[model samples]
Target: MLYFDHSASTPIHPAVLKLMQDTELNHFGNPSSAHQFGQKSRLVIEIARKQMAQAIGCLSSEIIFTGGGTEANNLVLWNLLHQQKKHVITSAIEHPSVLNVLKQLKEFGVTFTIIPVDHACRVNPEDIQNAITKNTGLISIMFANNEVGTVQPIERIGKIAEQHGIPFHSDAVQILGKIPINISDQKITMVSFSAHKFYGPKGVGVLYLKKGTNPKSLVIGGGQERNLRAGTENTSCIAGLGLASELANKNIAKRKTHLEQLADQFKLEMTDAYPEIIYNGHPEHSLPGVISATFPAVTSNILIIKLDLQGIAVSSGSACSSGSVNTSHVLRAMNMSNDHNIRTLRISFGRDNSKEDVHLLTEKISEILKQHHNKR
Candidate 1:
């Protein structure tokens, strides 16, 4: 089957899988132990930490491994609240992991302002600045939206937060391996990333907390991750993640330019078939791998099933909550019509995809829309 859902999750890279297998076979020991076996595992985990930190241009001391991006995000938000209780500013288009945690933080005497997105599914930095009162403590925005593929001007927003003295964090899972990142440039106090999003082993993630930022730890146990995360390191997964990060750092530019060409080809073909197709998200600032679009009059779920029957795999939106009846919160924030929400499809390319794959998908999508036009 043709997999066009890379944004949801990627196939584990062969190199990463090989490293993980090696770790499990040869370094299967509790990293907390001081014995030779455990010592070997601990050293491997430390090297992985340095690799992840280097990928983001941060110090090794700033990297904290977590179960995944969700936990990393929660750790940042919870700790920032611990530092001080105040209002938070987050975009309406954030992943549910951040929004859900923000929802829970309401009970902790912390209020929040959910900034709305424009037609391109981008949050206005001005709106964020306007939403901040004297009491705003933090501002959290995703670096790249998962469903819509909009890349926010995070560094711009970060500058705003800097002037206001508010801690700023970004959920960088979607953008980690796809874009060039300099966490220092954004003045980002905390950044969350998942290895699975970048073709690495799953259940491994990193949280970058800037030096001297001092976000408190939520999980308390034996000293690990320099007391930020208090659990035994997953040496195998960490090794896999380091390999993936290194590969991504080396291959980002070529992958980005190639994927953009593929995405453009797909969009152009599909648009020729359905002239009324509406492209969601910012055209220029979007990730090269993702193309979100809506076909007139036809619900995406129905069209997707038709494509799947023809051996194509795509998604209606975020994999986390796709099968549900609700519209995407990102689309809703843009105040798009119900048809825009219902007809939306997110087809994301990956390292394995090619222009030929796009051509086949385009032909299949054309057939589906043509059949619908005839029915009407």
Candidate 2:
């Protein structure tokens, strides 16, 4: 089956998988133990930490491993609970993990302003600046949107936050492997990433906290993850993530060029079949592999099923919100018409996809549309 849903999750790299298996077989000891076995596991965790840190260009001590991006996001936002009567600035297009946590923080007297995005699904840095108030303590925005793949002006926003002395956080889950990242260069205070998004095993994530930025720990019992995250480290998964980060960092430019070419080919091929197709998100500033479009007269749900039956895999929107009767919050924020919203499709390419896959996808789509028109 052709998998075009890389935004949802990626197939683990074969090398990463093999390393995970080997790590599990060779080093299956508690990292907290003082014995040699545990020391070996501890060394494994530290090495992985250094690998992840080097990939993102951050200090090794600043890297904290979490269960996933969701947890890493929660860990960052949860710090707001300690401050009363605080306000936060975030974009309307953030992942639910960040938005939902801010919602819960409301009960504890933390208010947040959601800056709306433009039609291209991009957050204006000026809007974030305007939303900032004396009570503003943090600003959280995704580096790139998951559904529409719009890359926000995070560096500009980070500069604004730095000027205002507000802590800035970015959910970099979607952009981690697809883009070159230097956490040290950006004024960002914290960043969240999931390994699975970058051809690594699931259940492994990283949080990059800038030096001197300490968020409250969500898990507190034993002294694990430098007293930030407490649990037996997932050594095998961490090893896999370390290798994945290294590979992605090494080949980012090459992978990005490949994915962008595929995306361009898909759009060019689909243009003739559906002249009325509305390409969503920014034309130039968006992620290379993610293509969000609205095909006129075609409901996304039906189109998804048709594509799946034809051995093609795509998504209506974010995997988390799929199957819900509700439409995408990102589309709504961009002021998309309800009709257009229902017709939207998000196709994300990955390292394994190719020009042939793009051609076949367009052919299948053309066939589906022709059959659909004939039926009508």
Candidate 3:
């Protein structure tokens, strides 16, 4: 099958798989134990931490491993809200992991302001700044949007948050392996990551917290993960994540160029064949491999099923909310018309996809659209 759903989850890299298998076979001890086996496991976890820190340009102590991106995002929001019931500013197009957590904070007297995006789903840094108030304690914007692939002006927003003394947090899960990340230079205080999004094993994620910033622990038990997250560490997955991060750091340029070429080819082909196609997201300031296209008069759900039947896997929206009847919140936030929003589909490329794969996908999509038009 031609998989065009890398934004949801990527296939694990062979090297990352090997690292996990090797770690699982040799390091089976609890990291909390003082035995030699346990010490070995602890060392493996620390090495992985260091590797991740190096990749993201942060200190090893600043990186906290969590279950996944959702937990990482939750931990940050929970900590900020628990500290004070102040207002938080976030873009309307954030992943549900961030938006849903913010929604739950209303019960705790924590108010939030959602800054809207433009037609291309790009959040304006000025809008974020204008939304900030004296009561605003945190600004949580995504580094890059998942569904539409619009890259936010995170550095600009981060600077604004710094000037206001508000902690800036970004959901960087989608951008981690797709672009070069230098968190230190971005003025961002915290960022969330999921290993599975970057060709690593699932169930492992990272929350990068700047030094001198301590968020309250969400999990409290054994003194694991510097007492921030409690429980025995998943040694194998952590090691795999480390290897994946290293590989991503090393091969980002090459992979990015490849994906961009394929994405461009696919769009050109689709637009050439179907003049009515409406492209979503910022055309110039988006991720390399991701595209959201709206096919007029076509239901995204029906198109997705038809594409799947043709051995082409794609998504109608964010995977987390794929099958939901609700319209895409991202598209709605962009002020997109109800018709275009309902007809949108998200196609994300990955390292494994080729130009030929794009050709096949576009050809199949053309055929499907033709069939739909004939029926009409």
Candidate 4:
């Protein structure tokens, strides 16, 4: 497949895969165990954790490894509103993992105010500030949108939360490697990340909780991940994540330029070919690798299938909702429907993609557009 779905998940790099294999063979001891094997495993895990922290410019202890972004997001939401009748502020465009947890948690008197986005699929921090109440306990906004690729003003929102003495969290799974992240400067106390979002193995995620910023534990078992996340650690995956982070630190600059150039080329070509295509997300403030656009009278899912049949993979919505053709909740919540809703497709560029791939995909898309128009 052409694989234009890096935002959904990136393919594992050779270095990362090799590291994971080596770790599986050598670091088989449990992190909790105190024997020589256990010490060796713990040492490796700690070194990996340090590398991950350095990748994001944070301290090693601040990084809490979880199953993936979904679990990391769950860890924050569930712990904050566990037994309280507290108020939460979120955006309408959060991933299903974030939205579903918040939706289900509302059953126990946990109140929420979701800030709506504009047609560009961006939430205004002012709206969040307006929604804050005396009972407000948490503000959970994503750093970058999963579907539309809109990067939010996390610093501004973080400031708002700080002024009100409420804890702020962000699901940074989509933008972790694409952008420079320093949780210290933002009002964010909790941030979620995933290894698969970069060129690392799946099933390993990171949660950065600032020092002295402790939330209630989500998993209850052995004291792994400093009691924030409990369970025997996936040593291999953790090792893979460390290796990926190290590689990302070294290669992010080059990858950023390549992905951004590809996206710009895509916008120029696709827009010239189909002027009726509607852009989604912040035109300038979105992630460099994600491009969400809608072509009139054409459903994004149809294009996805045609592209897939031609070995060009894409997504209509978030990967969490694998087979649903439902309108993107991010757009629907913005009060648009019909063509605007159904025609949107997410084109995610990656480090491995090239200008030739973009050209070829656009060519295929043009053919599909012509066929679609002729049928109409």
Query: Each prediction's Cα lDDT score?
Result: 0.88, 0.90, 0.90, 0.86
lDDT of 4 by residue, 93-199 (tens): 89898889878987867878989988777888889989988888889999988888888888899889999988888999988668777666677888888999888
Pairs with steric clashes in candidate 1: none
Q: Model 1 Cα displacement at 52 (Å)?
A: 0.9
Clashing pairs in 3: none
Per-prediction backbone clash count: 0, 0, 0, 0
RMSD of 3: 1.1
TM-score of each: 0.97, 0.98, 0.98, 0.96
- C-alpha-based local distance difference test score of model 1: 0.88
Candidate 1 per-residue lDDT over residues 1-376, each given as its tens digit:
8999999999999989999999999999899898999999999998998888888888898888988999999887787567554788998899998898889988888788999889998888899889988888899999999998999999899999999888898999998778898776677888999999998988989988888877667888888887878888889999999888878888789999998999989878877767788888998888887988888878998888999887889998898885688998888888987878889999999988988988988988888877888999
Task: Report how far off residue 320 is in candidate 3 (Å).
Answer: 0.9
Pairs that collide in candidate 4 are: none
lDDT of 3 at 79: 88
> Which stretch of 10 consecutive residues in model 2 shows the poorest summed lDDT?
77-86
Between prediction 1 and prediction 4, the one with superior lDDT is 1
In model 3, the runs with Cα more than 4 Å from the true position are none
Point out the higher-scoring one by TM-score: 1 or 2.
2
Could you tell me the C-alpha RMSD of candidate 1 in Å? Answer: 1.3
